[model samples]
Target: MSTQSERIKERRKELGLTQQQVADPVGVSRVSITQWENDPSVRISGANLARLAKVLKVSTNYILNGGPSRMEEPSGQYHLENNLAAAPAMHGQVPVISWVQAGAFTEVCHVELDPEDTIWLPRPPGASEDCFALRVVGDSMVPRYNPGTLIFVDPEVQPENGDDVVARLTDSSIEEATFKRLILEPGAPKTLMAINPNWPHRFIEINGNCEIIGTVIADMNLRRR
Candidate 1:
């Protein structure tokens, strides 16, 4: 008898779907699909199981039992997975705010100012629902991060030495936020450094005038056509 893992792998291949393609609509990492296909003992949660069923065009009972023979389907109606109403719920939503609005966003934390511009993202482990995203605006961090790159920020993550971070100038006179690599050494003052050496203002001393807003966890680059 075929195991659940074998059934999942066979069905996925039969439908010509890659693991990443399935993971995207389901709001999970591709690693999750790999594990599910290799380990029969790995239990998929109810929500993800339902999502897998829909994407695979099979019934949850067939997935759990390893074949259609284990469970009978109704005479006229199709499987529940075929119904649009049965789609899996989104993992979470991250607000994509402008660079100028980033400063005030970190201050308020959870307030939803605009909903239409938000992006759905799979919540990372230990990341809070308050996490947000920002689009790179300048070439300050060129070579590593280019303009129009989308970066996800987690305010709860502790900014460590050499970590990329979004910082705000605490000087009330400057309302703009900046993105750079943070440098923190024992007994030495903190500073922000840009990746591009050609940028005029490369180093910024974070004396009492700057505040670290959040640590950058992940980024996506959308190539222009």
Candidate 2:
């Protein structure tokens, strides 16, 4: 019997759908779809698995234990083999907010958004329902992260050593949030390090006045997308 990952890949190809197409409606990144199709150790949650079955136009049972596609047909559907139209994409969207708005992120992660004020993008897998996105605006993180890169932020994840984070200095007058790699050293204060060595403020110590809004879960260069 074919494994679930193989079955997912097989059905995806049989339908001639790109991973991104499948990912969008499934509320995950294209990278996540790739991982699901290739990584045997990666387990698909029940909700996602059901969504995958719908997106792939197959039954969950077929994905779990392949034999024949027993997927339920749409009402008033034709019975022509391999002639089904693509299923409509269905996925949750994450709101993209401004840097200034990100600074206002409280412990509850409450964001008051007007539908017109924010752009919505697909929510990547593992991100909280309240996850948000920001566009990179400076050269501080340059070498690896360029301007115009879109980053997904999840407030639920704890910031750890070397994690990229969005933070605001509560004591400063600046209202915009900042993004940097967090650094933690034994017997030393936590610090945020800018990836670009040439940047003027390359390293800033995380003092009591500093508030980390959220850790960056994923980032993509919009120019390349």
Candidate 3:
């Protein structure tokens, strides 16, 4: 079994990329890449690890644990056999922002929020480049998403019926975005539902006033631990 540093160096060499080439995309100095490849004790941040995996054209799991390598076609499509050990597909980091920021989230607007103070988490599997994270704020999504849970939202993905989503009511006084499960019925109006049965206001009719900002792809409740 090869060490993590060995795997990184081996893969980079196979791809004919210099340390600086990998460093440029991962947003690090060439010295950092050299340390990552040469020093086993040097730990890489989750964000950098994910970015390195992408720059190397491999999965994070493959870097952490030796596995069947991923192949990228000339067309840039990534494929691995289904029977192989399942690995979490990650591209980069997603910044954790407030519900208010999430409501106003966009490729353009978020850039102004400044990247330095942002708390970035590892991007979830199958998430798009536009993915962002929001902390669960209320009890409306309880039993599944408790307050303070981190929910990754992806605007690029279309919300299907019964998908958990973050939405904003443009016509209403509600300013911050709300997290709810989207319900679409045939011929009837759509609804945003709360999972908690005891909650008094359990559903809100979409009625065209609600604009779904994004679908919840994954969530993490640190309190559960």
Candidate 4:
């Protein structure tokens, strides 16, 4: 049986791509590529798998199973890993938390308190359980997320430094969450970021330490006009 590394190397050679060329495109080291091609013990992440899929011009499932799954991207929209129509947490179930700004702030807004304070939606089949959601308010995350927009987050997943994420900072007033991409800064970790280049992504790094809410999962957005 061919190992994942061998398969990766074989595929790369078949495409006439040098290790350096591939590394430059993916922002990883050529040695890392070498290791990936040779090490059978290396387990990759979904994001890395996505990058490989694009580089190989194949589907993610193809890399995993040597073939593609029935899942297909919708005609007009991006296919989220999970569906948003699943039943949300009910009474005594997961409680829905309040909204918090990913950018720096003094106090967390506390209003419209509800019984379901920690309720989160269910994960789709074959999806991870770290998923959660937060409602959007300001235009800081506009274009990608609108006011009142419910954003799904998955903490089990780690986004690249610049990837979008939902950060949960201490509100003191209430436990709240905010979503944004990263500025790709060094050291201090921040969450709030922008998904669209048109929208400026701003993130607030903790002076000491705070919780990273979660990585964005699926989203239920209103149809654009």
Candidate 5:
């Protein structure tokens, strides 16, 4: 049986991809990929391994265990088909911005918030081309959106009551953006709510000092096992 390192090197060579090509998509340097391929015991993070598996078009189980090559003609085609069927229908890439960056992002009216830091994600059905993404910060929306969740926001969508949204406080000095449920009623005050019940001060009334940035259309949780 081949070692895990050998499997990674062999599969990469079979796919005609350079170490840098494999590294770029997984957010690592070429040297890191070289280390991973040269040292069997060097541990690769689960998140990076998953990204690498997706880019290499192989299973994580096969990558880690060095099982029978899925590249064998019969199994290769089947594996390729399965990958295609299971893959996300990627419409385009979206920038994954931080809370501080998100505030700056709202100030600039552009489709690409930060082109250099973006991820390819499936576009929501009927979503316009102006959608962007934000990485959840804090435990405010716990069950619905844990920290590190990637949420796709559509500025074109008209936000309704009870819709999840990204909002910015009107004060330009405040750099952090807020992610919460938007509550709008006919006569009551508009408010933002934290979905997590245990969080102290779970609600903030939206007065004239806030602006709705966008409505969250879809989300992708990247937590690794």
Candidate 6:
């Protein structure tokens, strides 16, 4: 019988899904998956471990006990080994890395974070490393984050019932990123709404098509308090 990790790797390949594909569904990373299969030092949450078991066509007990089992268990649907990583922020200030593509798969480009892009007020320590800062180049996200202002994106933060979020609209031609309010329609369709009365409240229908970069932890330069 295949070992626990071996079984996971085998099942993943059988599904024809990339490491990333599997990782997203399970809220992890492809890199982590690779490490999990190779290192015993890695561990996953019980919930995630169960999900993995389901994907691998194995019982949770099978993984925990590694008891007598068949090596050729059936395969199923697709699957962060991050153990020692820490936040990269500074004292009295947060170090915003740079905005990353939380939605579409665009060409990877490097960004040299500009000091002006950061704001040092009412933010958690090491919060800078939690998000990427993007310069607002247009008015799509006006009345909140204006042009030339910097918005921070934390992909790990979940957008709340109606919190503003950094999202990637399905239409690539639109602004590279937009900050919008999340609107969950339950039975209807998931979408984002623009509250700026000047601009139409755009509804970005979400399904398997759209991507959410992250929730906006803090807004920059809306107005002076």
Q: Pick the candidate with the highest lDDT.
A: 2
lDDT tens string, model 4, 1-225?
666777778767866778865564343567878888888787654334544555555565555566433234335422223332323212101123455433222232222222112333444333343233566767777787778777665556766666667665554444555566755567655445555456553445555355665666566755651
Residues 1-225, candidate 1, lDDT per residue (tens digit)?
A: 888889989878866688876776565678888999999998775445655666676766677786453333235423223333311323433556666777765575243342222444455455555567788988999989888888888887899999999988877676667899999999988989998999997998878887777899888876652
The positional error of residue 69 in candidate 6, measured at the CA in angstroms, is 50
In candidate 1, how many Å is residue 124 off?
4.0
Model 3 lDDT tens row, 80-115: 334633222335567777777766664232322332
Error of 6 at 62 (Å): 43
The candidate maximizing TM-score is 3
**Tens digit per residue, CA lDDT, model 2, 35-62:** 9899877866544565577677677667
Better of 4 and 5 by lDDT: 5
- Ten consecutive residues with minimal summed lDDT in candidate 4? 86-95
Predicted candidate 5 versus true structure: per-residue lDDT over 88-140, tens digit per residue: 32342345556776665556544322222345555567665566677787898
TM-score, predicted candidate 6 vs. hidden true structure:
0.44
* Candidate 5, run of 10 with poorest lDDT: 77-86
Model 4, residue 169: C-alpha shift (Å): 3.0
Backbone clashes for every candidate come to: 0, 0, 0, 13, 0, 8
- The TM-score of candidate 4 is 0.39
Q: Least lDDT summed over 10 consecutive residues: which range in candidate 6?
A: 84-93
RMSD of each: 12.2, 11.7, 14.0, 16.4, 13.7, 14.9
Tell me the TM-score of each prediction against the true structure.
Answer: 0.57, 0.59, 0.60, 0.39, 0.56, 0.44
- In angstroms, the error of model 6 at 4 is 29
Model 2, TM vs. native: 0.59
